[model samples]
Target: MARFSEKKIVAGSLITLGVLFSIIAAFTDCSAGGADNYAHYNIARWAFHYPNLFLDHWGKPLFTILIAPFTQIGFFGARLFNILAGLTTAWICYLLASGWKLSKAWLAPVFVIFVPIYFILMFSGMTEILFSLVLMLAIFLFFYDRFVLSAVVISFIFLARSEGAIFLPIFLTALLFKRKYVAVPFLLTGFLLFSLIGQLYYYHNFWWLITKLPYVGGIGANYGRGSWYHFLEKAPDYIGILIFLFLILGMFVWLKKWFSSGLKLRSEIFTRLLIVAGCFWGYLAAHSYIWWVGEMSLGLTRVMAGVTPVAGLIALVGWSEMDKTIKSKIGKAIFLGLTILFIVLPGVLKYKSEFKADTREVVMDEVVKWLRESRNFDHRFVAHDPYFAFSSKVDAWDSRRIQYGFADFTKPELNIADSTLLIWDAHFSQNEGHIPQKEILDNPKFELVAYFEPKVPLKVLGGHDYCVLVFRKMENLNVDNNQLMIKLKDEQLKGNLVYSEFFDFEHAEPGKVPDQFVVQESDTFSNKCYVLGKDSEFSPSVLLTDSQLKISNEVSVGVEFDFLAEDQLGNNEVLMVFSVEKEDKPYFYQGQDVLAVDSAKWNHARYHFYMPEEVKKDTKVKLYIWDIQKKNLKIDNFRVQAYSK
Candidate 1:
């Protein structure tokens, strides 16, 4: 009894910590942006705009209701829901830990630290965390013999994430030990209620149901029966090194009892493992049956998230079966390793990365300032970073799309090209295939004006991208006195034929280097602007001459250029930039580091340049280089001054 009390204390602490950490992390930028994060944002936006429609479209009234309050606050609110769900999950895990009589010291932190997926999903602002929480609640209710509540919880769990349906039966099988026939009613009731809700919401939209059926099948195939070899390959990544080893030790301790014992949890354990194994098998089968390796990989990770608690619980129970001496030795080894990898490594790396990346508030401030100053308030923008779309009042969409058809299916007049802002993530571009930036930038209607590059290169830790770029339209069009002319000289070009390595200023032969003109990979980083011209034969220069002149008559010229020098050790040195002026008189204005050699996106060094407005009179302007030493800069274009009207 004392042991149970102490265990409860530890479980409660774990729950508390999970809630606290989630709240604190909410204030940090780690929870803001990602690809899957965009999906949730889409759902939330739908919820906010058309509540009834969202309920109908998603086939999950409970899940939609769960996020409605947060959806009112926009993306951040939805993120709060995830954090709360994560907390609920933590509490559920804590309860399991208490039931298993594990030390709180051993269990509390493991809710997040031991599993990379937990932290990643929690920080990424996706549905996985919420789904995990729901799954746990249903499992806990089922185990406690609360059949009706379990049915409702499981119904909602499926509503939250479709895979719940596949795993529900396996969970019900656990009850077969007490009353073999009792499982049927719970299964049928749960399925009927859930399906009835979905069907009613859709009004029996067979097409939609048919379309979604494949996803369920796909999930099962990926986790269930692809291949044992593939499982072995991905197991280490999904479970992590320390957790996998602990599971191995646990397997040894629980081997005999897991299969033959008549302990209180014997049937429950077998059923739980069967369900988990089924999920694993389903995922594998889906992968083997699919063509897109990328899509399979993504789905597999999500499936793994839903099953993490089961893995953790099983490993704990198994470890509990071991002798004190054996358990202590195993625990000590696992603890030491986990401390080094989960605690020390992640802490150090996150600190360094945070320092390297610009603060979220800083970037938000810049974005808002740019929008206000440019009067781009009502324009519909597509940002590579989903957070902007979620946070800003602008009509923003996710530019991280696999299919690139810009023509509006809803409105014939609208096209992808009509999007006013194409905010690109530099780091995402680097991982993607070559981007036809020149063609996009050279479009007569589309002009690249503003760009945001990071101060440091973004490194991929665990298959995630974290960098950004912002591009706005030009204000002028007529090649008035406010434009600048640039000549791409042969001597100024340097690079292999495959890709334009901007540093050397020398052109390579055709077909030798990778083309930077088009994006090959759907998820890779890329320039937001369109690329123009196929070869380096010096095509027509892009023009940006608008008549909204309020500044000095001096032509406000901006140019995108690249540099290739090596030893850049200096306090402040000129890196060569382009701008415009009417008279020799100076003017006051603002400028930014549009491109940097440090971008993870650039195949070589590059830079982008833009002028907010034509130079104004009495503007005391002095150019200052932000830093030096990065080579291979690519100058997109330079905007020059327009003659004052």
Candidate 2:
């Protein structure tokens, strides 16, 4: 009776600690601008209104489907579900430890929750915690000889994560070794039921398993490919160095015990320990090829979160063995203190750092709130982050995936008659290498609506100078009158407009070069004031000479032009070069970086060149437009000016 009471006290204490951690997670602002979290949230939210939500191949969708109903209570409810999942996982860990007859079973929950990555992800509305919970439950049921129940749980494991199919082999192997033939039929039945559920959800046959192979294969092949030693390199951050060392020690001790007993001892505890070790190593091996495990910015620790409990259990085993070997109480105490300090301190520090307010989430929430209040409820947006789309409850297309075909600055296919809103942030641009700043600012079709700069700078996950900008595509906007006038007025105010050309090309033929400009390398044409790149194989280069302009050494000269382009199948670039004639040779003054422009939209390019003191009286200034890889570019409205400091 006393032992029962002591066990109850320990269980209650662990539950209380779990509840405390959950509360901390609920209130903390640890959410990042991770695309996976947003994708999960959006998919879950979409499942509420849409039928056959699991037809897509992007995500597994079980966690999303489960959380769909509670999402009405807002994102907090989804996070609360994760908290429950995490606590349940810890409970499973405790059960496993108790079954192993560990002296300190209560420490299992502490070790699992205190791992920084697991704790942080538990609050972020990701699928890792839920996956961990289900996987652990399946293992626990298997150990208890509840074969049918274990098989059912194992089926759900695959739904949690695509890679979870690895567990199927592990479970089948275990059952085969134990000679549990009755469980084999139950496992097959569970798999069939799971397939039926997939069919109903996807509105298709059981072809998803086969169809998803290519998609899954493409992920590692295209995006996040890594070497075999990827997980080993990331082990220190996910599980601390000391904990990892202890895990190794635990494996070694288990191996020694098995060999010393002549490999015939089939104790349940030893078999269970072997299974746990297999799971840890198997998960690592399975995910080593994934790019996320190697990529620190994507949170390699989060990717390895499923095996966190196993790591804790291994460390516990090692600690127990060390305690027994150290006969002196003082030596044991010293060893235990060192282990705690080395393992727990790092995780605690990491948790504190991660718990601080995430700048990206805060800024995104602000943007969403503003969009909801300011714009129509039915406004459609083309955005980089789906989180904003989910929060704003608006129809959105991912800019990276969908091409916005702007026919005179309107996407007729999308029924974008009035306007289409565009939302972008620094994180997406930096990570994905898609910079649409020039495209948005230069095009008259897009008007700046709002800009948000984070009050406190983001310090983690490669975040710096974080900012969000919103733009609305203008419909029926006349480029010749409004946009050109604005540019002219702004340039005149800056006191830099020395030479200006609208290039109406009214008198020039379609295939002939304009009278004012000279073709340097490639062919160009003037069609009704629009300079067009005619060469298909090479980019056109055109030169405009200004012999009347004075080349002053002290003043900086600015050359600006507007261009329109057609979307192509490959890469495109625009370059502007400024040169001056010195000693009968053209000397390079300055040039702009290769500027990328959007299709069917007018873009502005500008470059500044400082005149040198060595210029003679015969120096002739020239401006060259180099359409490097770009073809079918319409160039017009050229301006040049000098500004004094």
Candidate 3:
């Protein structure tokens, strides 16, 4: 009776946890996979209206079709679709664990739910969550002797993600070993079905599948490559160390089992080892090679989310092996408690660290609001960013409001309508769309109307300020491209000292950086401040210590400092950089050059910078003055004051 009661309690607990996660995820603006999430969601959101987008290659037709109905209601509805798939995947993991005769089968859901990257991707519109559910279901069916069904289901894998093509040969080899020739034909179901449906676009071209491939290009020269251990190193970051340790243990167990029988492919073992474990290792190896060779795609850790379900199984195997050793029931309970804590803690910490909404989204929202209020706000726009379209409520199907075009801006003479706004961003427009900024800058047909840049910058690697340049196609240019920046301000700037300090080194510790810097020095102060002499080994720099930099795009910060190049170099001026970095990623940058007016003289220079916004979202704001040019320079009585406009 106690065992039955425990089973009911466990089932009810899973249901409750799943519902809670769903509700929380719906409201959260956490990104699934950056720009790709919005790109995929936009396709799914509008595919119902156009119908042609159901066959869009870049959008991943299967993913678009699967989530389209939910997306029709809203992006939240689309999130719920992925969330439902996630919860169902957890249930499948539970079933797979129970079927494998694992002692702690109930821990399967817990393991799947807590995978750090997996948890994040499950709330997004990306194809990974559903792909995970589909692939895992295929594994379960294959193991249960539903050979034809498994093949039919696995056939749709490629439509979910381009990586699915890599699995076809391995799957075919497994089918051949098991002598399931009947199911072999069914493996092409997804390709054949989609191909037949895509005939309308292809104009009866049977070779449309090969011709319309989305990711068919060669290696990108600048996308960067990684070693084989790239994913291995980043594994702990995405899956957390607890799952990573167990994953290594699980792989060891599987490899041991595979080699114990001298590479034998027994029918019973083939399903689990050849297919299940094969998918796990196969997916990992392919990605490792793809990144290692610097090919088709860059090494994005989020791609691993697609195979997280299988990794969860391997993790479960590792946990099961460890669970077997604890003889005491009390010890086992304690172990279970710790496992949950370790798995969940990383995700919770990550959630707390990241902003509720990404800087890109925040800035894009502001840009859209600004655009709506501007002159000719209703004029047609040409933009590459999917988020901009979503924010502007521009129907991609209707090219009147906005044209989803690119590469057109590369031309010197654009044929766009007069007053049409070409909204270009530093991201998609520059990278994927190949819209060269220099061409637009040189083009006379385009007029720089409004420029939008974020205050708080994106903290991701290879991130940019997400500058949205609003240019109007004009016969006669109104504004100079060189002076596109127009600062908006009231008559009086708001006096708000987010932080202020003055350091003259009057009471300074010798050979140490200054602190607080509040001691104001009167005239006739000592000349004992920090200095960097000619050919000095170390650069004496001013670092704003423990300052909560909450400056925004509208905030104006005045920087003042006393400097002297006692023995000034031959035309080598000190380039002082007042940089603000978050997590070593320098996003907000404002700098100045201190050219010595006269040699051996202390020159006082003052400058004000309009800082970007919400820098407080970072772990730490490093506002420091550095001698980037490394010229012989002296600095003292440095002061920084911030005010809002």
Candidate 4:
């Protein structure tokens, strides 16, 4: 009892230290990567408003719930949660160490402190630390014969990260060494009930535990079939050659003793060793991080967070059997040396960064301000680093845009013209294919209005400096093109008659329309306008000839038609006839006009002709369309109507 009490105190101290450091780190400027922290913020908002949809991402609701209150208070709160969770994870590691009867309980805290990647992840608002804590607690409870507590803790671990389910079979296999018959039923019942009730009913995963097996299995298959370099890289760094050496030597000693002992004691030793070894091997093969860079401090921290418990268990078994020889003391020295090596390296690295004090950073303050000022309920901006904007109350793209790694601006769905401002980093573009500067400038429909080089470059994936680019729709700008025209004709008019020729409306063609206007030249073809009127002599011509103001010397004759760009039904010329004479008499008149479309049907139009209230035999009229721009007169569809007085 005295020994147990001492162990608990030591373990508890280690846990407290780790948690305290995590809190301090969180309060510091510890936001590392972009995407994961962004995901935390997004999920927090999602869960706050629609908690029922939590199943869409398995069991991230716990994380969401934890983040909700912090997020409400701003970034400081979220940062604090990250720190607390990281410390809690270290505490769980200490608990596992105590359970395994490891002598140096401080190893867990050292591992957390020295691991650089772990430090980055600690304050990044990611799930790694939270998941690690739950895993440690579940395993500790399982070994303590608290099956119900173990099962609940395991369920929550799985909830934290879908990959946590892989540990279930490993836990069951470990139990085989502890209690043979009990292992089978306990594992089966725990899993079946968890799946049936927690996953299927409460979590809404109908398939339960069985559904989770494939994902775990796939992780194992990937490592077994993947590169040997991957194994070598992650293996030695976290599993430290010294610790494994101890594990192996301890295992041999236990096995030899088991062979010499009587049946019952032998059974107990074998079961304990089997559980410890099986879990170690199974996790190595199945955990997703197996292929990650184990050499990095962060990677080592993650591995040790879980692996230390197994090492501690094996060390305990060896301690029970040792004779306290000089060699045993040397081994202890080696283990302590390894712990110091990991912890000191990271602590030193942090100090080194402090010495440099030249970290480049983005000033997201202006960016966030713009988003809040510019955003509406309906408008969403496509910023490359949307996470920062999202954290600031600005609406951003959906999951489709977030697919893969960064933002893809070229997606056609992003073209809606309701003030679409593309904020991009120039360096980001360079990495993305060096999108041509001319491509944006030459766009007829988009005009670049603003560019800003952030005081500090944004830390984006693919390692590029980032900036903001703004563009506006080109709708309000008038296009100066006397480069467009139209013609109409019909051979059923007579006398001093002239026709007003004009096509009405202006804009792009809506939907699809039959090619009605034939252009005379190839140079006139454009995606904006379909050519229908050609320059064929007999094709269609606008003509004007008239003498209305008592032989006021026949002025030049001309004609013009409105460009049909309105709705397909509303896009036709209205033929209007009016005299250019000083007197309100007819100078010339063309009868009702007809469209000379390829198909002999009058598609759509309204007509106005100037005939006297009572036609005098001598009433004269001139015909022309009112000059728009240059006031060019036009005549076509030759015909004259004579009403005798």
Candidate 5:
């Protein structure tokens, strides 16, 4: 039999390099993932004091408990905790690879360390690395013939990420098929412990464990989903292109062999497929399904970091296949050289920004710093993305010191005390907080206190301009924004509509495209504009490219359209997108399901947006609709008007 252990030098070097990179990233890079990352750190930091926070479904219970001690020092401590977890994951990955007696198995650690998003996330306070570590370790334990321990560890997958429950079947099948009946009972170990703890918290009144599940809402449009192949499309961005390609190839080669070979449950290759590759692809497929169905999954590629070890393992398998397929020693050397060259250098470079400090967080840091130095501000602040809470050393759960309203602060149930300071950011506030800037601005009770624009104009993902704002609530003073808006509209309309046009379709022909609305001129002759609109990739769209608006000053634009869908809309939505882009990158972008109707009826929808400062005179702006389900529809009275801001 081939030796299972890797060379001591190879092991030490891989371990050392992984540790060094994680340490450097943890301290040096200020940005990681979004609010969830900071929120996880906060939960871990304070879970001991607020014992319920340990069971806080959003922050995985086991993750909180394990990481709590480390987080006492600061978020850096939690980051260090992840570093350990990540290193442990790499070690287990290396062990599994070498134990399988794969050639050049030292590449496993290298693969895990350099996976772009995994590299960044492993050093951050996010739960993905830890979650990945636990799953990977369970298999490692099983590999060592610790069947009961493996079952117990696999059960704890839920306490890391809720979706991890999906992997429970893999172990269940393995244990049952292997006739390890005792190990099968151990699968409930994690749930039972958490249940007891939750029972204590609930005073034994009800099943707090079930009630506390964050994703209990079966399937609804919480965060609208995307394509079924979303993960497949985005894997390269998460893992580097070399790993992504290798991962694909690994799945093909591994699955091909697994199916072709004997259908024995106790085979060695079955173990490899079920644990390593199974965890990776199974996760990818599950996430893809949720995202496709418009379930709770937001379709973030960062979630892939949780399965980084398995992904790296699969990629290594692919590398081994490449080795086996090429019999010539010289040819194998060249291929290995190419793999090393490509993986070491860069093929997926778009994700490089993820390694650096996110400009959004950097800009928010300035805002928080200013708030700290400028005046004596109350810790009782209202904000989305409890970033302020973390930075100010305020306990998020201590409502006495802080009025922290997460997600739905706009709702009346979430009462905000008078004279509260609010930090309304563009990113978290718009997406997770579900509050628009206009809502805050229009409210008479709140006054815009400060606005900090970055020194250099910058835009983050989703075209959110990097601008942090500060608002203060004053109950004593008030002004009628409704009256102000009416007056402003009157004043603007009295002047002139910068560019007002309406497509009534009365003069349009079925065979002819609308005037000045064709997206591609090459296909205009062949495409049909059914009455007045054509919406294929090669056809016409509602493009506001007229020079009339170009010469005008900054203005607020409102687009109202009448729509009638031929088919009922299910989870899909009639997405109307209003965007302003420069050089193909959007400067301002907003998509609304203006007509989310089940029946075929004429629905009048109004969507409004202000022209961002990023929009230049020569910049291209587009206003379009995306029928996600491709429901053929009739649109009429499509009108757009812009008035000076």
Candidate 6:
């Protein structure tokens, strides 16, 4: 009875703390909407009116569905949902810790609340808090032997973020290891039922989700790819280095205890620990392949938020074990002081930094006000940031969809007619090849209408300067004549020309592979290049051998290619290659900078490659236009030249 009362007290305290924090979050206007937040808000707003609108594979449908009702109340309601989810997560963490009989079980809830990322996300209106809540609840239910309930919750976790599916295998394996054969079937059934529902409601087949797995895995690849050790490097920023060390130590200690016990300790607590450790390590391993994991600006820490509560619990376990093992009271006290300093100090500092008033709010409000005053309700707007669109209650399209190939801006099917407005900001421009600012600027269709800037200097963390430019499409503008174009004049070429090939396709067959070139197989495209706008995939590469081009000692070599592309959906890249073979071994090198060309026009692209004196004599070169996407393009002139001082 005493233990039951103690558990009840702990639960009550956690609930109270969570509610208090949430109320504080509600009153505080310190929240900032990120790209993900804007996407979530837009999806939620769309869900309020149209049930079948969210058919895209990229949308996290479950989040939008859950938050749709609250979105009518605007950002506050959306943030309130997150706040409640965060508080519930804290309560769930305490329950799990108490069930496991961990020392200082109440501390688990405090840990969840104190984590800076969790605190910040609770107010920012992102899915992390809600996702973490469902995830932890699933774990807690599983430990309590509620297999079917756990399975149902697990399905919701999967819907929250597709990555949550990674936990499914681990959960099933734990059940199998424990000889719970019936539970496995129940879990599988629940998973399939949820997946089928998603397919029906989203109007997509199973393969739609399956095919997007690779795309999700490769997200942010163009920005940068991170090494496997990215998590290790960023650990200090997310959680202090000292606390991270304790977490690692706890894992080692847990392993030693399990192995020494002959691996037969199948207690519920031990199983729970195994599951948590599996999830913590599993998320790190899976995210290592993602390009955004390496880019701190892309929210690498936020990606790890789901597993942070488990880590904190594990670290506390390690700290308790170490405290008990210490022989000297002075030493134990010193260790405790240092641990407190590491864990609490950093979080307090981070909390202060995060809770500051987000200055972007002012700029966003101003832009929305201007739109409401200047534009009619029927006017369509295009913007990278959806917050302005949602706030102003105007029909808007996200430019990112076009940049990422999810939608084509050039296609008339999108309804971007004359009088449409285009808004661009620096934050969205950082993603290379995705920013269509230049295209919008170059086209005479869009004329600059207004530029909005923050009246006061904003110092929000990870905040960029406010430069929101709005452009309105001109009436009766012909998109064909004003299509995006790239031009390189003859004067831009550097050094003396040695050889040039003007490819007029005179000797080459019209539909067949060109002479001196061979087709390379690609999953996205079949042929490298043919007649422009043909059905052939344009990303194919053709190799050239040493017989085609002889290399001489030259300080620099330059190559220029003339190409035409039509109806380009995404970023198109062309590559220039150089190679050498030594002692039957081949060495190949390519130019560093890829020439990016605009769609629906012809381009004269130039690139230079410098050859060292040592390798120039035996070097053999190969040149091919490497199309990054499988868009239709035409090649006319292929020119190569050598240059010396």
Q: lDDT per model, in order?
A: 0.46, 0.63, 0.71, 0.45, 0.71, 0.60
- TM-score per model over all chains: 0.58, 0.66, 0.81, 0.52, 0.71, 0.64
Give the per-residue lDDT of model 3 (tens digit) for 350-398.
5443326667777778778888776556788888778887777778668
lDDT of 4 by residue, 371-440 (tens): 4575622333444443545545543235422321223334322334545554444533333433433354
Model 4: number of backbone collisions: 36
RMSD list, candidates in order: 13.8, 12.8, 7.0, 24.7, 9.4, 15.9
| Segments in model 3 whose C-alpha atoms lie over 4 Å from true places | 1-11, 200-203, 218-222, 259-262, 351-355, 458-464, 486-555, 558-624, 628-642
Clash pairs detected, candidate 5:
none
State the local distance difference test value for candidate 3. Answer: 0.71
Clashes of each: 98, 3, 5, 36, 0, 0
Q: For model 2, how does the per-residue alpha-carbon lDDT over 1-645 read when each residue is reduced to its tens digit?
A: 435664576668767866786687667755532656766666666665664554344556567767777665766677777777887888888888898787567667767876767767777778888888888888889888888788778776766766677777777777777888777666565447646766776645676655554343322322445567767787877777777777788788777777777775366545655567777888887777455454322225576787787787877887778778888979877987786677667877765665654667678888888876885434556565655665565532433323223332222223443466666677664334344444445656556666665533343323334667666667645443335434533442344545444343445544444454432322223343344455532222333334544455544566666656654413225556666776648764544543445654667666556666675666766666666664566665555665544
**Model 6 agreement with the true structure over 574-632: per-residue lDDT tens digits:** 33445444543556455332333665456666655555446634455555555544445
Model 5, residue 107: what's the lDDT?
79
The residue pairs in collision within model 6 are none
User: Which consecutive 10 residues in model 6 have the weakest lDDT in total?
Assistant: 482-491
**2 or 3, greater by TM-score:** 3
Q: Put down candidate 5 lDDT per residue, 403-458, tens digits, no spaces.
A: 55444556512466666777877776665566666787776677666665543345
Q: Which clashing pairs does model 3 show?
A: 455-612, 455-613, 456-613, 552-612, 552-613
* Lowest summed lDDT window (length 10), candidate 2: 404-413
Best-performing candidate as measured by TM-score: 3
